[model samples]
Target: MDFSLFAEEYFDEVLRLLRHLCTIPAPSGEEDERVRFCQEYLAELGIEATLDPAKNLLWTLGAPSQRVTLFMAHTDTVFPRATPLKLADDGTFLRCPGVGDDTANLAVMLACVRCIVEKKLPLHRTLLFAADSCEEGLGNLKGCRQIFADWGDRIDRSISLDCSYRGVYCRSVGSHRYQITAETEGGHSYFAFGNKSAILPLAEITCQIYEIEPPVVGNSKTTYNVGILSGGTSVNTIPQSATMLAEYRSDHRECLAEMETRFAQIFSRAKEACPRLTVERVGDRPCMGEVDPRALDELSHRAAGLIQKYTGICPEFRSGSTDCNIPHSLGIPAIAFGLYDGGGFHTTEEWLRKDSLKPGFCIGLEMILREGEAE
Candidate 1:
């Protein structure tokens, strides 16, 4: 599949879109700029793009049908709005904060849709394209959650454009994120040394969480961490409240359940030290429940075949916590594959192959054209 002609025509257009999107500073919940830009851009091409309450922009191609193949690329990056957006293009690579992760993929999706609409290409199934929001950090798949809420029953399959060039995430790694707080009366540090201290209880609970033995089920593994911890107002003041942000993840449903139980027990025990202890479950990305083996295999096989076709790489089938988590939880067949080659995801110095956009467009366009039925 030679996409040189298509790339020649649309590469600059796609690059322009990617640059504009990168500069807009779309960080998870704050994706209004990107949402508006994508909506207006697609609508200008005569595509009816809809912006849902969750900041997800969606449009459908092909005739109306029950069998829909949804293509999703999130519009948000892990970097905060304060992070300066810088690009270093040296002919072969586009180096920037989020030029690769989902930004490049979103640009590719936009270009693909424009090509199809301009050429009036016909497809076998309804192709739903979404530039979704809130896929990183605490956003917790809010965009895909709304997407599935509105169109879950209608979608037969899904392909989320994410990751790198040589992989397909067939299994969903479910996770539970929590924000735990301990509160107690505070006094002068010297005077309240013997009184109930909020920091002590929070620290104890965090240590207990780290002490739990990680469960391993076949290829599935359970892991947990406390990423953020803070509380006291001053060094000399006994902390009135202490808070910690923590999460546990696993690829199996039973492991998640077990971790949930363990978390509850840890929080419960902290009440003895700090009577005003509180726990909040902030995010819950699910693992697969009961999916048909045939459907899973078919979805993975098709995505892997296309990847192998264009990139000449035998794509690895793996597990991840991504936008695909939403559909996999709802029993919808979904596979997440990459649109370009890149590294340093979730960091300030991310980069992507500039030339890979051509083949990526070809791979994505074909996947959309021959979706549900036989290729």
Candidate 2:
């Protein structure tokens, strides 16, 4: 399969598909509509597609062996359904919410599969393309978990199309997300000033969480964040309850475990001060598990080589928490690489250059076809 020729012929079709997909409101956990659209689009292209229990769209092409090469692009974005998408195509860039992060990559993945079927490309390995759901905040990679659960045994290796073109992630980052709430006796601000207040304990916990330094183990780094904090019945009333959402992430399992210990101590102290406090674990993402060092290096280098071939740029190798996390944790060699050049991901200002689509598609196609070779 000559991706250069394929891109020259189908570039417009892929771009049009990307633009259309960006307009749809496929927020995390609400990706049914977008997945349905993609399934129908593949149907029109003479490809059969299905939705797993977790709503991951799956399309496969068989070979002699049951072992398969997996290609995945998450379909959901960080934006909500009500986010107003204002597209600005300045004849150089296409700017809009959810346009770059994984939306464009999903379209590119679909396009490559379409090209393979259309060109009657011969295959040595079975190929599976997955457009998955719930990759954004709070959704916690449920889509990918199902993908591995359904087909882990037969998966030879996997590649996730995501992020920007400058970097590719080989190791999976681990994370733990938690929601804490404090309850206490309530009264008017002036009258119940002496009463146990819910806000005080939660406030102290938030401060203490920031006080702990992030862990740095070798090249791996850990980070902490308090994303949402809300409480109080009224401005004038003493708060009866308060709640906070917080998380910690690390590229090393030891660092994640260390943070978990520190977090437990923090919550334990708070619990002693306020017996009514409650803590719930909301999300747990896996770190890279034991795998052959050479296998990991081989997959990462292969993807990076293709990117440099297409774009004339060296790609960075790093670790990240993405859809590849599941496969990587299962000891399968997986890497998440970008299919396009873009920035401002997970924000309304997200954009990608219009002209980079061809090279990006070329790289993605090569990644799909082993060694970029056609028999």
Best by lDDT: 2
lDDT of 2 by residue, 1-375 (tens): 347888888788888889899999988889988999999999998888999988899988746566788888999999988999777889899999989888889988888888888887767767878999988777889998998999899887888889988998988889999999999997998977888889999999999999999878788889999998899999888889999999999888789999999999999999999999999999999887876779889989988988899899899998788987788778898989888898999889999987788889899877777732333
TM-score of 1: 0.95
- TM-score computed on alpha carbons, candidate 2: 0.94
> Residue 374 CA error for candidate 1 (Å)?
8.2
Q: How accurate is candidate 2 locally (lDDT)?
A: 0.87
lDDT of 1 by residue, 216-298 (tens): 77878889999999998799898888899999999988888999999888888887667798888899898886777799898
lDDT of each candidate versus the true structure = 0.86, 0.87
Q: Model 1 Cα displacement at 63 (Å)?
A: 1.7
Give me the runs in candidate 2 sitting further than 4 Å from their true place.
Answer: 213-216, 234-236, 371-375
